[model samples]
Every structure is written in structure tokens, then in C-alpha cells.
Target: MRANLKTANLKSGDLPGDVTHHPYDAYGLPLMVEPASPALAKDPLAVQSWFAEHHRTLEALLPTYGGVVLRGFAIPDTMAFNAMIQCYDTDPNGYAGGLTPRKNIAGKVFEASRVPADQKIILHQEMGYLPSFPKMVAFYCLKPSETGGCTTIGDMRRFQKQIPANLLDAVHERGVLYRRNYRAPGPVSDPLVALFRREWTDVLQVETVEQAEEACRAVGCEAVWEDDGSLSMRYRSSGFVNHSVTGEEVWFAQVQGMHFNQARLAQNYDTLNKAFPGGRPRPIEILFGDGGDIPEDMVTPLYDILDRLAVNLPYEHGDFMLLDNIYTAHGRQPFTGSRDVQVGLVF
Candidate 1:
């Protein structure tokens, strides 16, 4: 017989079954699960098989909770995590034209993000700027830092409702446009600029501009070559998208995270403005679909909403989290010691 699972809003305590469910917070933002049986917790294969057996229930849970965390599992490393993800989703997404730098670890798993440990990556949906993106994303914590380094998450549905009605009306009317700049590998005068940006060849996994343009076009983006050996790719998408399961229009853009006023780069805003041409052409730009500036008023309140709703989901060794990409947004908090979180996505 399958191990039964029950949901509740209670403090940490033992359940009578093989699995226990707990809410991380008041909003029940991420439903947390752990093995209640010693045998289930000791055997990795049993945990994996349990996940496979309850895949449908888990799928149903995600639409309501947005995210699910399976902690205290016996999975050993990145390879085991990849195998477990394969049990749920066979088709893994390729990270082409991805913003953050990552290294492929196992079959479909990759380093969560190579952003420096000191910087906070603000909450944003995975591949939100792209036309086609992952439908679901999963993270496996091979190791946790000694301090901090929580995987921050926010409910997009809440974020959407928080936005002022006027701003939502404007976004619905104008849509959102995103632009990304890519430069070729070369000696950069500023080390800071190099640290934030990546080369076009590396991002597209192609050697020539022609190949890069082709790749960009395939993904519904328009690529333009700059006079200064740089590439600009533009895409237009709705600021809000309907949640696949809930049918609720959820906030689903990268504007807040890509903006210069982002948590990590806000302090260097002026200096970064001076680093690039036009005084404000950061690596990425978010604008109205018609190439107009998104009003400052609209952008400012969003950060506040995200900050108010942000919940840091602390990591532990062998903890696995699955998120519905359309319903949730995720980020990274600053850390002290080493942290290894491998991630995988399915389109």
C-alpha cells in the first residue's frame, strides 16, 4: 500500500504515517515534507520510489501551495537528485541564453547560480524574460552553508494582487519588453563589468554572431549587433501570465530583478550607470513593449511587495524542492560558508 500524506498547519511534531506535512509559515507558502518512518528516511531508493508513486498528488499540491519541499531524504549527491527528477519529468530544459552563469553537474542538474556568495539575487521567475521557459524547476541541496544562504521564494499570485490596480492596468495595456546585452570575450577595463556580464558566444553556445542570431530568432527574440562588438536581444511578453493550473493571472516578468535598483546592484547604481554607454544601459533593460520607459512609480512599489512577501527557505543537505515556475519566484540570500545547490528544470 502507498504511504498516505496529510496536510496541516501545525508546529513541528511527529506523524503516525510514513510522511509528515508542515507549513513553513502562516501563508503556507511552501509545503514541507519529511519521512516519518526510519526505514523510509534511511533508504534513498525508497524515498525516490515514494516520490514517483505520489507524483500525481504532488502535482496537485503545487497548484495550491506553489512549492513543495522534501527534506531529510537519503539522496546522496547531484547524480541522485537528477535521477529523482527524471522519475517525475523525463524532458529536462537546456539553459541556453540563461542570465546567470551555471555549471552542469550531473545529467540535467546544474549549479544553482555562480553569483558571488556575498550578493543577494532578488526574487525572479526562472527564464522570465524568455518567450519559452521552464514549466517547473527543482533544486537539490547537496550541502548547506554554515550561515545564511536560504533559497528565497515569493508567491507570484500574492505579488500580482499587491500591485496597484493602475500599474496592473498599464502593464496589461502596454505589455513588458526586455532587452539583454551580450559582449564578446575580451579584456575588460573594469573587472566589475566583467563579473556581471557574460560573453555572447558562451551564452548561446555558438561561435559566431550568425549562429547566435539564429538561436535568438528561434526563441522569438530579435538580435541586433552593436557597433561596439556587443549584441542586444529584445523580447516582448506579457507582464502577467495565467497560471497553468490555477488560471489566475500572476506577475511573471524579470523587471524588478533585472532593474539597476535590484537589491545587490542598488548601491552601485550610479557607478554602474557611468560604466556603460547612455549612462544607464546595464546588461539588461526592462521597458514597455512599445519601447517606452516603465514608470518609476510602477517599478518602485513592486520591490516593496516582493520584500513584504519574501520568505527565506533555508536549505539542508539532501533537501529537495520543487516549484511551479508559473506560480512562484525564487532568489538567493547572501551566505558565509560554502553552499552547493544543484538545480534542474523541465519545460
Candidate 2:
């Protein structure tokens, strides 16, 4: 802890900080919670004390760091609640490869897990891919890898700070390319194009340039088509996306488009799924920093900026990390070993 500095108060103790503010730099910092005593952890009253004290503390601390991790915090519920255990279990196409299939606890809630599962998980706030993203996210590990599954975070707001202004201006003005290849869309309806459509020349159902333009129009934006039959677009649109409680404008990309890294997004994403049997999706690849198609000039600086703000901490048998949606972006650190965890995506 940075002695004498302030903290965000959550339900229980102090959390961390916000590295930057213009709505794009993430708002909270990550806290590697100082571990409490083992014997006291077993005391029910003591357990209650830990949970109860952290929230308020973290809230005050949220303004300082990008997110926080309650290290060594045990998840007593090896088997989550029945409602949790049954749902969102199976989404054949919704998530990337290697996630356990489970049912939703409710219409839009998370279910629980049975076996101890361990594998490094990638990041993207719950569902922030296009537009329908989550506002806050957290995870509690009932069991951690004897070896891997560390968490990596990217503060998009901070990420944008590193994104050259010229690129930002281009996105705001010239727009970017965006290609989404989904054979089957999630139950959540698409705001722009109908998920079901005819098989085009490729013998596959895809959102064509025309359809993408129509979808863009629906969202009050314009779309253009490249000669190669790809879609290009931009958004000057705005809405009341203030955090449900804060009403503050979220620090996010102006809109979704190819401007960010179209070739790269398409490159990293293996839509054909030609290799995996069940046709597994690849891990989430969102680079405000550099990985795939980021331009040469932007690579070194962007990575440095991101590396400064983002933090990646491996999971433990009993650890919990809470993320403030407005401030941070997170991902997986490639690793090898048993890494099992159960999730509770609370609003």
C-alpha cells in the first residue's frame, strides 16, 4: 500500500487508483491485497469482516488505480449456487476456445462450475467486443493453478493515451475497417444487421457491406464498402453511457470500426476455424498496444504506455480481482500448468 495515500472504499477494504481520467484511461487501480491470517480466515465472523470492509475502501481507492486483486482470498464455494451452476454453461460460438460451458444463473447472470479448472483466461470486459459491453467485472478463484492463469490488464483510457492523436483523429474523421464473422450470433439481438441471412458467394452467411452499411445507418452512422467486399465505417454517435451510478462519460473508443486495426483484427481472428474440431474460437485479441496489425511507428511507444499502466497478476487458489469497466482492460499472460477458476460476473 502507498502509505498515507487515499483508497476507494468497496463493501470492505481499500482498493487502488485510476491512472488517467478523460473517460478513456481506466478509472481504478489493481490491488494485490495483503494476505490475512489463515486461522482468522476460517472464523466466520472474521470472514464476514474481510468482505464487509473492502468495498467502501476500494471505492475510495478506485479513483487511484486501474483495478484491484484481493490476493489469497479463498472461495469457500467449491460448487457455486444451483442457479449459478446451471447456466451460460454452453455457448458454442459466443466465447473463445477453452472456456467451460455452463448455464446462466438467470436470464443474464453467470452460473457456477463443478470441477477445479485451470487455464489462463483472456480479457475483454465480459462482452465489450462491439457495443454491448459490461460495466464492471470480478472473479474469485476456488482453486488456482499450482502453476499458471495470471491476469493481464490493459487500461484502454491509458491505452488511448498511447494511441497517437493522428490515429484518434483519423478514427473520429476518416473512420476504420471492422469485420465480424459470426456464423451464429448470440441470443442478444444485433442492433445493426439481422443475424440470419442468405449464404453469399462464399457459401456462408455473413454481414455484407450493404448490410453493415444498413446496420451503421440504424446506429446513426455511415458505412462504406471496400472493393474487396469488406465494410468500413465510423460513429459520431453518443448516448447516456454514464456508468449506471456515476453518469460519467465512459472512456471508450469513439465507435467500432476498421480504423483501429482491420487487417490485424481479421488476421488474428481465424473465422474459418479450419483446424479445431468443434470449430473453437481463438482468444480475444484487442490491441490498443501492438500484437498483430498495429502500424510500425505506433508499436514501441504504445506498448510502453500500456505496459506502464497495465498489470498482470497470476491467480491463486483463493484470490479475487475486481475491475472497474471505465478504467481498465485486461488479458491472459500465456502460461503452462493447472489454472482453474469459477466466475461470478456481478453487475
Candidate 3:
């Protein structure tokens, strides 16, 4: 990562981050600042200019501080909607296509999420599958859970502090292999759709047991299976590559390597079955299985550290949250009440 990625900007209105006490940000969290008004807020067209104005100062201030947080910068409803749909286009998870879900990638559609009922969501990183994903992420909570839907933030840099270098080196030598029985509807293809990319890669097709196997094998993972129809695999979490931006060594044992290879707990799915009247939940089913480093005994200990290190904040209204799709992981806990939220995805 660049030593400084955000440039600081001067405030138009007298506020806390005025010339006297400029706020600081470390990993881009506290970047949120109260704009004088929505009009002064950065427009998409002028957004680039606004960024250019502040990126340097923000980056410099962030290191000594943690991050920044702005209140009035909440995007308009129309703009928010557009941004989220665009998020779908970005395909941050490296799932091939951005908009197409199971059709282009493998994802389950849950019949129910927090919109209708109060549910407890477990904490996990989103799309922990890809390696060089996102660094600083954001979240805009349209509606918070009525009761216990409090978002938590965990710092992964801190988590890295606890990981033993030797253990990290081991995964680097032999990649981490992940197995998921996860499946979702086929990709949403444009019967008359044409697309282009910066680089040429395989056109992602429907996810299947075969791809699951290939996902493991492609990463040089050793596969294992049980007669009763269970899979266990291990692979090197990293490839011999360099950070495209920083030209840094992509270490295998790093979080990028360990992420997304979650041994998705089959129990997580089974629990959803009981929650649903028909013994199954649609979207919840999309995300079946538990995927994290396994060995049962070692699971909690590792996650305990992962939980503390990663930025795992709860959702809130006006929070157009974004994250490094590859680096940060996110999941939702069940919620209740008359809650409505729009999810926008952009590249």
C-alpha cells in the first residue's frame, strides 16, 4: 500500500476538523467528515477533483490517526442506488461477472435476511476468496437492527501482530485449500449482452462441485474427501506474485492467502434450516458451509484473532459502506422491524 493514499482537504465551514484541529486518519476509516452541505459534497463528475484535492492530506493524517468519519456526506437516494448497482459491476470478489450472481458465480439466495425478522448474524469477511482485494472499506446502514444489530469493527493489522511468522511461512510454502458446498442460481446473462475487460480471463460459468474441486486444485491444494459426501482440501493461499501497486512480495501466509478459503461450517447452513418453516432458507442457503482455517480446535483461536484484527463494523443508515472486496470480509446478522435497504455494487 502507498504510504499515503488520501489527500486532506480544507473545510468550508468551521467544524471540528478546521484548520486548528485537523482530524487524522490511519487506514481510511475516519475519512468521514461533515460537509458544509450536500451541495458542497463531491459530485460524481467532480468527485475526482475533490479526491485530488484531499487525497494527500487525508493519507498523511490517516497514519498517525486511525481513519475519518463524515456525517453529511451521505449520498442522495438516487445516487446511492446507482452506486450500489455499479458495485455489482465491479465483481470485487473476483467472481468473473459483476451483476450476474449464481449465473456467473456461485451464490445462494436467502429466502429471508434481516428485513423481516430479528436474526443474529455471525461475523465473517465478505468474499474472502480473492487475494489483493480492498484495503479501506465503507458501509452505509439504511436501517439498523431494532435491537442487537450493532456493527462491530475489528482491525486485521492488529490481528497480523498475533500470527506467528513460522505458521505464516508454512501456508506460503503450501497454499491453503478451501471447500464450499455453496451453490446459487445460474448467472444472469444478457441473452444479448456484450462485455469487455482490462485483461482476458476465463468467462465465469455456473459454479458446481466440479469448479469447487478445480478451485482447490488450481491453487495447488491437496484434495481430500469422505465417503459420506464431505470434502476437505488444502492449498497454498498465495501465488508467487507481487503486489501490482506496491511491487511487494505477496506472502502466502498473509491474510490474503487465508481469507475466503473458509471451511464454511455445514452447521451454519443446518441452523438456517430450523429457522425456515420448510427446513430451509433461500438466500441463507446460498452461503452454506463454514470456511475458515479448520481443525475444529484451532478454529476459534484463529478467528478470535481474525475478529479483533479485521474492521467488522455494524451497519447503519446513510452508510454507503464500501470495502476492499478482496481484503475485508463482511456478513450480516439477522434483524427485525420495518427495515428497507438498497444494496449497490460498483467496480
Query: Best candidate, lDDT-wise?
Result: 1
lDDT by candidate, in order shown: 0.78, 0.41, 0.37
- Residues 94-137, model 3: lDDT tens digits: 43321123222112111112222444334444333333333433
The residue-level lDDT of candidate 1 at 214 comes to 90
Best of the two (1, 3) by TM-score: 1
When 2 and 3 are scored with lDDT, the better candidate is 2
Best by TM-score: 1
TM-score of each: 0.91, 0.53, 0.51
Which lDDT value does model 1 have at 148? Answer: 89
Model 2 per-residue lDDT tens digits across residues 159-234: 6656667556544443322233222223334332232211121212234545544555543333444453433332
* True lDDT of residue 162, candidate 3: 65
Answer with 1 or 3, whichever has the higher lDDT: 1
State each model's C-alpha RMSD to the native.
4.1, 10.8, 10.4
What is the descending lDDT order? 1, 2, 3
Model 3 regions more than 4 Å off: 1-29, 41-69, 81-89, 92-125, 131-138, 164-166, 182-236, 239-294, 307-316, 324-334, 338-347
